[model samples]
Target chain A: MPATQEINIQKLGLIAGGGNLPAYLLSICKDKGIEPFIVGFDGQTDSELMDGHCHQWAEFGAVGKIISFFKSNDVTDLVMIGGVKRPPLTQIKPDLKAVKILSRLGLRALGDNDLLSVLKEELEGEGFTLHGIQDFCDRLLVQEGALGRFQPEADDWIDIELGLKVSQEIGSLDIGQSVIVQNGMIVGVEAVEGTDALIDRCSALQQNGRGGILIKTRKPQQDKALDMPTIGVQTIVNAHKAGLAGIVLHANNVIVADIKTVAKYADKYKLFVIGAPIDKKSKSVTERTPKA
Target chain B: MPATQEINIQKLGLIAGGGNLPAYLLSICKDKGIEPFIVGFDGQTDSELMDGHCHQWAEFGAVGKIISFFKSNDVTDLVMIGGVKRPPLTQIKPDLKAVKILSRLGLRALGDNDLLSVLKEELEGEGFTLHGIQDFCDRLLVQEGALGRFQPEADDWIDIELGLKVSQEIGSLDIGQSVIVQNGMIVGVEAVEGTDALIDRCSALQQNGRGGILIKTRKPQQDKALDMPTIGVQTIVNAHKAGLAGIVLHANNVIVADIKTVAKYADKYKLFVIGAPIDKKSKSVTERTPKA
Candidate 1:
């Protein structure tokens, strides 16, 4: 949770995956005069992002190559960003280092959180200090209160509270990080299909009256240094398309990529975007805005 | 739960909703020589199911008319069957009786389970004995063990165990009754979209190696006299189409509509259909069949 200004970035290694967040991070590095050595995944990371950077493309299973690339460039600080689909074990042709790690981990079924945790440990074990995306840029972190002009009503706050409780319960099990609730009923919960798909599926299942709301939060047991729950401009667009009334994210714990553009779209669509703090005791959300 | 044979059902009243369960229940009544006074919901119950049977179509909000119709037929034993979409409050134009009941209940957000629970209480208060579908037909109740030629492998069982735990967790919150799991990851959980849509959504998210397994159970706090988690022939077909290896249902709790055809389809598609007993203490499933 240290401020971006306090962190010294000297020859950082960026493991970029799919999404706009990686490109955003790259821009931040440019602004700060830090040239990060980027390691892009074969099918996951966008090839276009690697155009004018010191980067190397590696398969997800090429753990040895990724490590050596970072080591060769003297990049001691590492940051893993963006989304990567969990491929089946059969599909991943792990190199010697990855095979050794997989074997040591006992090859049981691993969720995204578990996989990332293992990766963090492995990289740290090899004498590299891994950093979260938040460590590089504090601007990307979601702030408290409504980001857009619109604010959720009293009834909407009730749904938000319920959604927070449900999302946290599911997150404790490492299932998913987002949930859609309309009225008092949960329309849908995000799983492996991702948040956008969850919104699309729940659109057809919404009840007759008021639209649903999307609540995204970090998993309770999730490592912040690993994958933090993220929301972007695309999320607002999807929520508007799905007739969602608003979007809620756990304050500070969630990453809001391109916050200005996200706020613009949310305002344009008249959807409220609020980042609320989680009440640890009740395991629910507390609305910061006083009722008018 | 009383045995179906022990319950003397004379002049039964059925409040039929959508899906094949209502039709299936009607056929059972015909077989047992119990002429049920059918009260079908408008836009919900199948029209064909009412042919040759003493039935009346009533809107969901016309509680007064439905009650009088059943009373006129001297039918005191009532059973609410099939699925009914939870309409928005604006959509429902409730009669005086329904309005009184709803107002007395102080309508907050009511899920399907809560709605059904309210209906059960209202009906019983009006001198009607509420009986579950299981009261008229025990044959439809799922039995313990595999129903098809195929049985789940060890890995599938492991996934089933994980699915059971997750589904129960969601069910306890009255969120969902079914969850799809592959390896150790949850692919999707059913909400208002239902089991079929959940299967369809999870198909694209499945891992490459082995297919996922669908685990369905009754919500822990759900009333037995209300809607039971049901699986029909179409469920088996959909599971197979989704490349699911098998399905596991809570034994004796879930309703298996047209079980014979369900078994036939399961065997034809080489998908295992199992009814596993849930261990209440652990809130997990116990595999009844011994591993070979």
Candidate 2:
């Protein structure tokens, strides 16, 4: 009998940040018979994620060391997941490689998208393939249909459309990614405070306990591979606590973590979770497009 | 010598809301040798402002009653001033005349300016002249200069410009009247929430106690006689509490409730108060255009 054919697994480099996402991704990689190597930022990645895993700590801006470490592990494919507290320039002790990337980007590096795009390009130039998290965990993307029992009322759809228009306009300005719309009026636009604070502020401004919908989408000029708008169980919980009607997200443009758990909490709270396909031409959300 | 011709005093109508502005306007009318008649809205006009004055209370949407009250007092010139809590649609019990007005201006009846414009037309149709609050109280307009010890640094000016562009864009959409910008990033955009709430939201989002500027401007399509952006001592106090650097206003556009008190508070808090002349062509605030 012929000997069993030797099997080879593709090695992936995981740039981990804070939260359970990295660990979840690692488990998925193992289940899929893929080799995983992790490099966690000093103050960002969760320690639990590093347990019994091939992981090492590096300062956020130590680009050269990160690349070399990944190379030594034969990692040519990379995915960056989870959140990082954007540190001030003073806190970022960049190595020479990072400084070169920053200087070359110049004023265009003012926004998060621009900076991340530059990093993506740098990694590609060094012969690394940068993949979006969805590449490994496509199931985590929100499905097209309503997640829970509750569906949006007609008036809620009106508010959702209004939110889509205004949030898109603001996103076009590169100002923010989310907006709170209630009764066809904009309640708040997210800026530096981010989604959680935006939700809190909108909740406080509710009139007669009337809740609104939180709509988040990708910035018009954003690179799809980096910094897509992300939501998870915490987002659903926050919206529920804030008395929000539901959440509307652009299909193929937003990421959801632990989607089953998110759907469970949403169902418990009777919150609607929908993945809307936004029509750029009509500037409105079209029919739902189910994820492939 | 022939007997001196009989002096005639113009009868001016004061449509007052909740605040010290109506009383201040009344006093200015007295000093200017004009007879004033006050028409206050129920739950909106302060008792102190109506005390010892020829005034009557009417529901906010009681256009017929308001017109009749002014006509009985022989008031030809009218000025609307101060704040009115925007009542919900259910709360607005519009009289017959107001219903007619609202119907005529279908979609335009949505915002403050459109309603005020319709009111102005109705009053003008009956031979009443609508006068701006500034006409009677021009001294309340903020002069184009730094009002306190702490002047805006050059970097603050960059933020101020970015804010002006953004605020104007949002204003054109009739979304809000104020925006808070810090470190060249938009901190918050005021919508249903008023200026104070916007400031508080910005303050809470500050990293390392870094403060920003609060910019208030006139809506591009807003009627000057209706609802001009007005700031007062409380605005300065709130900005100070929020750890904001200063306040920026449009010259000859924003109303200061009590210029002296606002200036005093600004000085005490070491905050700068400057009135900028926005150049529509250049989309930037030009040099100081001091109030006359």
DockQ of candidates 1 onward, in order?
0.78, 0.39
The candidate scoring highest on TM-score is 1
Q: Estimate, for each residue in B1-292, the C-alpha lDDT of model 2 and write its tens digit.
A: 1222333447888888877788788888788888788888877788777777788888878999999999888888888888776665557788999899878876467554556778888999989877777766547667666665657777577778878878887887677878888766677888888898888778777655457899988888888777678988989999999999889997667888888888899999989888776889866676442332
Reference-based lDDT, residue A75, model 2: 88
CAPRI class of candidate 1: medium
* Model 2: CA > 4 A from native: A1-9, A286-292, B1-9, B105-108, B111-127, B285-292
TM-score of 1: 0.95
TM-scores, all candidates, are: 0.95, 0.87
Model 2: fnat (fraction of native contacts)? 0.44
Candidate 2, residue B130: Cα displacement in angstroms equals 3.0
Pairs of residues clashing in candidate 1: none
